[model samples]
Target: MENYFIESNAYNPWYNLAVEKYLADYVQKEEVILYLWQNQNTVVIGQNQNALRECRVQLLEAEGGYLARRSTGGGAVYQDLGNLCFTFVASEERYDVEEQLKIVMKACQKYGICSHFSGRNDLLTDDNRKFSGSAFSMTSRGKVQHGTLMINVDVNKLQRYLTPTQEKLKAKGIASVSSRVCNLQELNTGLTVDGMRAALRAAFEEQYGRCTELSLDMLNNDKIQEYYKMYSSWDWRYGRSPECETVYSHRFTWGEVEVNLKLHNLIISECKVYSDTLEVQFPNMLEGLLLNQRYDIQNIQIPEFHKADEELAKQLKETIMWFSGVWR
Candidate 1:
């Protein structure tokens, strides 16, 4: 087939995401795959993002939502049944984001809604309220460009699952970028997901000739199941991010201190400290001191200051104290 579509029957994020990776792993040169799927109560984080810093894993898990980490390098996003997901998988040389986005914009046009591709990876209305955000990943096999389509998505659950930290935005050098989203259904009450799916298929065919609709059963197999296990594993979802994204950074008269923590069950499973102090080894020293400690202000064990570095140590303590109070 020249163009094809695959709609998942699974709702589990792990399974859906596993299929996503599977498609990326085996992109055919002759055909481009348009995958439409959904995940229920899930928060997907970027590959380089710190998981703990990006998502409230404990709270989300407690509430029966999943935390998934994609292979792409981008910020976190929420997914549910009310949301529709789409991916365009093609060869590296044939891949094009602008052309792929046309399928989305064209689909919206059918609903009598004018949408614009705004910012880095979002499609917004004329007034600038976004209804979709997208992310990308390139594999050895091919390239995958995927995004969310908000029809009647639950925004309340999104707020609870995602606990974005300023450190992440600040570190990624995109602190000023801001976005607001509105469901497509909010703009047109008569619109349904089925209608959108039909529109998307027509647009996709218009852009890529004809497409074959592959049965979900044909796509389910041992290879996808293996990837599913990797996605569902604790290590994959809750593991360290961007060299530990849970960062506490501040500046003092001595220098700047940025502490990164990887917390497991409220304890510091891993720790790394970065400082621009004159003492090159000071940050390394703080890492060891903070490692294995509980993530609490009272539990922070301040080290004894060497006579020559006493002034720097005082400022370090002040920085820690400040982050401890505000990092809630």
Candidate 2:
């Protein structure tokens, strides 16, 4: 198969992620694509993770770091100009995780950095310090495997923004995040982001055929812009998180209402309504009504409370929608 190499000039995390999704989902050509991109200070969370639980929101916001959600399943990651992100997009028939990892390993070897795949999806040096981590997603037409290579990352910023799970920390037997990760530039003072990119490009050309370089303008079309809108929106980035319970309380002119919801697979599995002004039967009416229903207020069916309580019902609906992660 032919090889297409795309180096994204856009540093916006949303734009780079949009380009990755567009290539995986919309590109119909049967060829292997090696996409290299970088983002400014940003924290990218996995599709299945809870952003609030995985990141230090206050620190991220104060440091001017953006948060994004990728279409892959993995833990959260922090990125900056010092980090390099690579994505391998190919058809399902040609999807090979080991082969793709080998390509990255070969590139690292070119810079005199010896690393190997460790555990599930990490590339670690001989001393067991991790420098790269990867995640994967399958599209209808193909598959995408993307990873981050730590070149000259700001370790302090990485630790400040990302709050990894306790289980992950215990598994690595590391007490702190800074102790677990190392930068390529730290290992080899001569290695730069540009030099690493060159090494990876050469490795791709050696493994695949000649490379066809694609420009940022080529990807800035209307279709990609549409995808960028989706990726950049708050709803797609945070609202599409995995099913979890969330409590929301709102006080209106009428009264206060607290909504407790248990969502399973993005569907409302259980819901409880508490309000001071709502009728006695209002909570019961909402019990099975929204069961197995996705958290969309527009599509939700609201039963008629007493005509006098219309305002209360409206407030309750709005609060429930807000708890469902729908932002107006």
Report every candidate's CA lDDT. 0.78, 0.77
C-alpha RMSD of each candidate structure in angstroms: 8.1, 7.1
Top model by TM-score, which number? Answer: 1
The estimated TM-scores of all candidates read 0.73, 0.71
Tens-digit lDDT string for candidate 2 (1-328): 6678989887899999989988998645567889999999998887767665566654675668788988887777889999999999998777788988888999999878899888768999989999999989888888999999999999888877775333211111112223388899888999999998999998888887698987767786887889889888767765665556765566766677666777654466788877785456556655656666765544767677788878657765765555444221
Task: Give the per-residue Cα lDDT of candidate 2 at 241.
Answer: 58
**Stretches of model 2 off by over 4 angstroms after superposition:** 164-179, 243-328
Instruction: State the lDDT of candidate 1 residue by residue for 99-176, as single tens digits.
Output: 999999999999888988876778999889988888888888889998999999888888766755455422331212
Q: What's the distance in Å from true for residue 197, model 1?
A: 1.5
Candidate 2 Cα lDDT to native: 0.77
Error of 2 at 96 (Å): 1.9
Relative to the unseen true structure, what is the C-alpha lDDT of residue 307 in candidate 2, on a scale of 0 to 100?
Answer: 85
